[model samples]
Target: MLENTLAATYTPGVNLKHNVAGANWTFLLPRFALDTIVCYGVPGQKALKTLARISNNLVIVAAEASTQTMPPGVRLHSGPATSLPLPARTVDLIYIATRDAQRLIERDGDACDELARVLKADGFIYTEAGVSAGWLSQQSARLGQAVRYWLTPLLGEAQTAVPEVDAATRRYFVENDLFSSSVRLAAIGFGKRRQPAAEAAGDAANAPLRTGGRSGKRRLRQKLRPLAAALQQAAGRVEGQVHLLGKPLARRGVLIGPEVGPGIPQYLANIAAEAGVDLRGWRWGLAARGEYSSRKVLIFLFPPDEQRPSLIVKMVREAGFNARLENEYRALRWLVENGIGDAATLPQPVFSGYHGGLMLVGETIIDGTPFRAADGVETGELAERGLNWLVELATTTANTGVASAETVAAGLEVLLERYIEIYEPGAGERAFLAEQVDAIRRSRQPFPLVFQHGDPGVWNVIVTPDRRTAFLDWEAAEIHGMPLWDLFYYWRSVAIDVSRRQGVQDALAGFERQFLHESPLNATLSLAIRRVCDATGLSAALVRPLFYLCWMHRALKQATLLPRNQLAQSHYHNLLAFCIEHQDAPALAKLLLAGRAEPQVSG
Candidate 1:
């Protein structure tokens, strides 16, 4: 009768399932077959009922007897977590809900050891718990205390626990050395460990037996191995921390705002004094607002006083642009010495230097707000002033030697090759783009090189209350380049920003009409380009090819700089589409034809 009852309890086809604490148990099913599975701290009768569906053995250990009706064919144990009523090395798997496991580990020091006693050599115990931020240094102390307090007696040696934070939680896995009657808790985070196959095989062979003998001393020593390793790793971490604490607080190439000392204000005052500016009554304070960017820009406001005019002290903390800062400082000095623009068109620099590895520039604050494209009159005025400034910059820096047509073409070819290698365009497209690049190289036109603002987007322009435009962010200024580079970037940025604010299709339609000379926007950008060409004595034919080349360069740079950005991806795709449609243009036509052919190579 007992044999018949046992057969009835476990059927042939059913699978066990349980759910607790927002975690699904079905997902944790092991690949290998198991004769027995145990779940400690089963939360509800519903979970017990689910576990009963197992065709094989199932045990549910509850903290107390449930008032709900018990499920049939399920073995239930009621006891404290520290001591379980199970034989050694008998269980195939153990599942503990996160919260219950934490409580057990905290209250009963030998709780894990008791679980380890009943687990087979290859058995797994799974539990996950949420951890708060700063848990590594702050919360680890308490967790370590609990582990050291409870696990010492079971292992016959003190254990040092290292709490590691990963993906905002902590996970624990158990490996039992049954020969020594000791357990090792492997807490994984931040780093990985690799064990050799030979050592692993040796360890498996040397597992301890339940009965003690003369090899007891060897077993105890083996048990202390994990503890010793843990302590050594902890010592390394502490040593690294001590070394870091001994260094100066300042970062290598960036200035942290809060770490700024009281000496900075006095330093600025000295710079102003050298430049014949008095700041006796002015006080410094950080700007209330700014946009997010790669560089940390702290705007220091110097309110107008009876002694002198108001000033703006801009501190630029940049790790990536340290070299660029030197170039920009020289550019600013050139602008001041050459008298490029009045205060309305540019901020007058009173002083410029470095402090704590950060680039600092003090300038008379231009009384203006960010230029708004929606204001028609201001927009037109901005464009006119921008064109005038470009002309002045070109004329002033005209002595810089021009880049030869061959050099320009070679650069474009290199970019095309990189694009093909990275993106693996079709054979037809690649051939067409290659042909276009060759045409750009062959079609020679002599053009003078001039200073160019590498990034002259609308965001860098400010419109004062008096309707004058001021240019900002000259860190990317080039001493010599194509004059059209800055103009193209500015218009492109305006189009993109407008498209983002409005609908893409609507904005594109408007911009397309303007490009086709069907609409007038901001004094006709093409006409302004023609005027610049006429002044510089450059060929009108060079405009179309050069413009396209500039776009290609910009698109390629965007892809290289921000490979993951969706907007950059869209911009590149759109440029390809434009080239395809404008096949009448020699370069575009070649690219279009190439795109039509079969792919010659695979990615």
Candidate 2:
């Protein structure tokens, strides 16, 4: 799991290094069978960690993570690269970082020969480092054009073409940043596959969640988005009338990316081939990250049997997607450690390494009915259950002390900037937001924090056979986050599907009712939030402040992702505006916080 002071940091320039390095190495190993592999001087045991998942036969000659415990399948072999501890012709692959390879050769002058001793006839040796090492390393030090990694074929030539690092990724890095290209990143590279014929069928499958932009310009268009997505999926599998009809109907926007774009099915097939799988008779699905902001795609490889799905790969084309994917990987690991990883409703971590000049995480698929707002799943019970789940997470991961505003913000500088830039807040709105910030932040008094599934809307939920609710997308989660935001955001979303469906006015009115009314559900929700606050040591006084902060954060984050024309219609803007108006309302004060979290029993 990746750790940072705050998860929001993005250093884009590092993309020029070894983005596709890991995939190249994995390509040399057996595609399906578990092969015996050795890792010598892998920087972070990143290769070892990923190898542990796929291969049962793994011997680690050396690694930077020697102090850490090895996973069940991995064996930590102690010895220098020149020595032979293993039988000859037994190893399938040897992964040595270029620096380590260079070190072994310098010390004994036969590291490459010793590595070859254990290799089978078909076995290969892979070495990769940053571009700092010149192309092919003819004489070991001088440059000859630019290259990512080098391969040594003990038996013969490499099986597949060498992969190219993503050149497009350079746009993300700051040219003037001091650390630019200075940091050495280690990744397991895969061999490149022959590019096949292409067409795009991704938008046709996961459009609603896959792409974010303006809602349909017209009411009819808005209503047709789901139909269009359905059309795309239908066109992929069925033949005859359904396939013929779907192709044209979905062509406009639903199947927008598929018709003229790279064939996602073929793209996935190439990915599968790179992984060494005979992926015939499989039903594949694709979910593009964000229409414009991200080229990260989630490829769902489904078995012909059509159960949920067998594998889900979060692959990135752009650098920003790496952070989000890595964040979700860490969050899932944290969940697994904290006892929330049930196979029925959650994605089990499978692989976390690079492939095809991109970073990807493989995981098991979630099985259940989706809880999308468009599906009209607006149940008060779901809100109650969602809060209960949030409370349980908070209680399980509860920390002891209060956190300051700076800590809670968690490197959201871009978010702050985006909020100001997009909203262009007038004096009155600016002052109101500013006042809320100061009032909550000025005092030395601190507020408690907890683990928050940052985007806990109904759309990210799934329900199992036994009626258990499970969350799906967790890329936006935070380890140290303000409590109550998840709950408020959740119920607010639910309200939009429920009584707030009429217009923005009704939505604000419904938001008020959820917090301030004396109904049974409201009372229960208030009690649940109070219990979580008590568990996490959150003060009642900070409740109102945190509520506005959460909405502002959501609004700002989504604003950057929204299409320009859709900016004014962002759901969070109305919600945030509502809270700003009632920031200090006497009734809001009584219900949202109160002198203490004293429960108002519903009569």
* Best model per lDDT: 2
Off by over 4 Å in 1: 1-281, 288-293, 303-309, 373-381, 414-437, 496-510, 560-573, 583-603
Candidate 1 lDDT tens digits, 103-197: 66545547756766777655544433322234322323322211100111122211111112110110111111101112223323112121111
RMSD of every candidate to native, in Å, equals: 27.0, 17.3
Alpha carbon lDDT of residue 589, candidate 1?
Answer: 32
Instruction: List TM-scores for all candidates, in order.
Output: 0.48, 0.53
For candidate 2, lDDT tens digit of each residue in 227-302? 5545544433332222123222111110001111212234345555665665676544333322242434555555
C-alpha-based local distance difference test score of model 2: 0.51
Which run of 10 residues does model 2 get worst, by summed lDDT? 251-260
| Every candidate's lDDT | 0.46, 0.51
